[model samples]
Target: MTCFLIPTVFQAGSLSLIMGCTPNASHSPVFLLRGFSGASVSSSLLFLLFLAVYLMTVVGNMTLVLLISRDPRLHTPMYYLLRGLSVIDMGLSTVILPQLLAHLVSNSPAISASRCLAQFFFFYAFGVTDTLVVSVMAVDRYVAICDPLHYHSVMSRQVCARLLAMSWSVSVVHTMLHVGLLLPLNWAGDAEGNVNLPHFFCDHRPLLRASCSDIHSNELAIFMEGGFLMLGPCTLIVLSYVRIGATIARLPSAAGRRRAVSTCGSHLTMVGFFYGTIIWVYFQPPSQNSQDQDMVAAVMYTAITPLANPLVYSLRNKDVKRALRRLIGCGAVDS
Candidate 1:
């Protein structure tokens, strides 16, 4: 076994260097990302396709936000939470997609260590925001459906504001904790001071894998702390749905029960797909995980889910459809 360890330690803002096992790893300031196997051959096609996706994600989410904001009928707690979700979706896509587009067209996939960690920070931050906002939406839905008489009082403006504030602040601090843990570890790179990150984006797991220092504690933190953060919201979502199901079950009208089931089914399907991909990406054993597999799963949440959210939560909504139709009618009458 070959080992290299040195006691020399250096610290800079959000970075620390401590030489450890692996060739010249501590000296590296940049990491080469392995974007895709065929990037060179079909980069243009992939870029065009993804650019279209990014554009649609932006336009769709923005339209939903505007629609909800403008329509007085859509000013309830659910729509408010949905608007928050759209804004966060746009943010999540913006943080990941544009950087990814630049890397796709560039000759070298080199990303500076600082830039790489920055991506890591924003990606997880927005992801946690997504989770929290969805959980808040679930709470809104629970109150509206399960206890409609007092829904307004229960989920008032002040309460909603606080929930949203907690969601954003907690998400930022959660991501900061993860990034701070990673800051002290030195990266492993080759003769050219380049660590080859397997995934396109700077996800935390890949960055941790590229580290030269021992990551036992980091892994422990991820599994224990990260798991709690993710799992807690997921449990909230599930319980909300379970209560919704029970409430619907008591509906004396057969048709009413079916209609409720249809609506909730669609919602659960979309949420399930969104969160299932997250679980697949994050909770797997290291030995069983591969970069390619992670990349595929990543596309579902990072790309597909954001794009689909407007359709799932907004376009299908009868209130939104009525609002859109009314706007179109107004435009037609004006012309």
Candidate 2:
């Protein structure tokens, strides 16, 4: 991705200031993304893998969303949250993978600074949205099992809409604040006008490393603010499951316990897979973080999760399978 680090004359505030109001003799209008450009691994091989993943992601999420929308039986709180999750998955993958796939093949792939910044904004926004939806899904499960009699009243249509609105609002505010923090960095660090991002996408971590000004402040924001965004929902999921476990344990029979766990099994698997990749990329200290591994693991959520959502959340669901069968007029076929 290419970022124009050409020194802009200071105007005290706004975009000029955000672009690092400074004087530079030379104008560098492009940032060359060196994403796997120097690696010995076969670029074609990697391209095919990512392309397949992206295709599956697009097809799978689209199918899930359509299946949910067309099926009257899926008009419930859980499926509502699931539709949101699928949409975010599509957004997240779109923001990262297409550009990454391009860079993997080209000798000197580049992106405009504005596009890069936009990518950065959506990446975090969708990521935050994903976590919030996952947490909410956990709560939906908790209510469904622990208080089945009151589930509908508790997770009513209005309540689910409000939850979705709150999640997007929180995510947008969080993304805007951080993107603002990153804007002033283009001209801060380098005397040579070199402000290229090292990662495949305009990942904030690499952007922070590229900036030499107020590094501590940026880390603090990521750890304190971003951590709250990440961990707070996680804490909710953990507590919800703890209660769910307790409720399942009190069941009278082994069959009952199995049934209860089965209800949560798919959601729990998704939570683990999603958060496992997240922690792999985010939890480590910057000094010890490996970008290579981070790039690979990012595929899990960006592409793999979306690709798997149909199977995990919908295809395996008997109701959804029945709906799919009916959609295609194959009622006699086994799901």
Candidate 3:
């Protein structure tokens, strides 16, 4: 959101000096409150924090991918869904982190028009894919619970692959629609001045606000696409989980039922955190105090969620840890 015009200060021997190109020409520049007041802190501190988060997120997701790939025993519907989630986590982190880190340190952070559009495309696409993955996971659990007899056949590898493919394909279509719509819009500045946006990245809402023309079509498209991607899947997940809970409760042995529910507790917790934060941020009406609040929630889904994923899935999963140990050539059995 912070529109800083970066100037090619000077290029020396394999080094360059860059300066924040303030408005020197006739046009007056608009200053947007890009993000939280990290302007108060030293740039080094911000960079370090972002770096640490990025490293942890990447490592966690990579570990999950590695574990799934190495251990053939983990070739199941659940782990497949988990690996898909890992892919999205890695992709989403890559989309946001590097630019954010650069912006944190650089006095004048500037991204090219093409890069900005590309960022939005990937970010939204991955977000939609992640939502679908969570829904698939919910259905996986439902199959394991409500239809145990045909769980394997019902949620076979082929079906899972097709579902994963659908998620990615739908997300691509969704992102293309928005990006194509943006291409025709006159994002260029007028004779008066450059635009002011109040977010860190080129988020759709802020970018649309900066546009000179009406964005009703864009807004409607966003609402329709977002609603279809989120609400439909979310409803399915909730319903599947509800039936799963009922099926668990009807079990004869209390301990068995408890253990069965425990298998999904972590995933259910994750889903709750994901959908709760997202709904609170997007579905509700905006308020004057919503900017900072929304940023914190955004950090949950963007930064913290991916970082916490491996922890959540691993800590609560005996099978994953067992598989990891085996993959590492540690003892196959845990004491």
Best-first order by lDDT: 1, 2, 3
The weakest ten consecutive residues by lDDT in model 1 span 1-10
Arranged by TM-score with the best first, the candidates are 1, 2, 3
TM-score, cand. 1:
0.86
| C-alpha lDDT of candidate 1 relative to the true structure | 0.73
Least accurate stretch of 10 residues (summed lDDT) in model 3? 1-10
lDDT (Cα) of model 2: 0.72
Candidate 2 Cα errors over 4 Å, as ranges: 1-29, 187-194, 280-289, 330-335
Q: Model 3 reaches what TM-score against the true structure?
A: 0.84
RMSD of candidates 1 onward, in order? 7.2, 7.0, 9.6
Q: lDDT of each model, Cα atoms only?
A: 0.73, 0.72, 0.70
| Top-lDDT candidate index | 1
Q: What tens digits encode model 3's per-residue C-alpha lDDT throughout 148-204? A: 799999999999999999989988997899888776554434354455456676666
Give the C-alpha miss distance for residue 124 in model 2, angstroms.
0.7
| lDDT over C-alpha atoms for residue 108 of model 3 | 60
User: What is the alpha-carbon lDDT of model 3 when measured against the actual structure?
Assistant: 0.70
> For model 1, what is the error of residue 261's alpha carbon versus the real structure, in angstroms, after optimal superposition?
4.3
- Candidate 1 shows a clash count of 0
Q: Write model 2 residue lDDT over 73-152, tens digit each, in one string.
A: 87888888888888888888889889989888787677766787888899888877887888888999999999999999
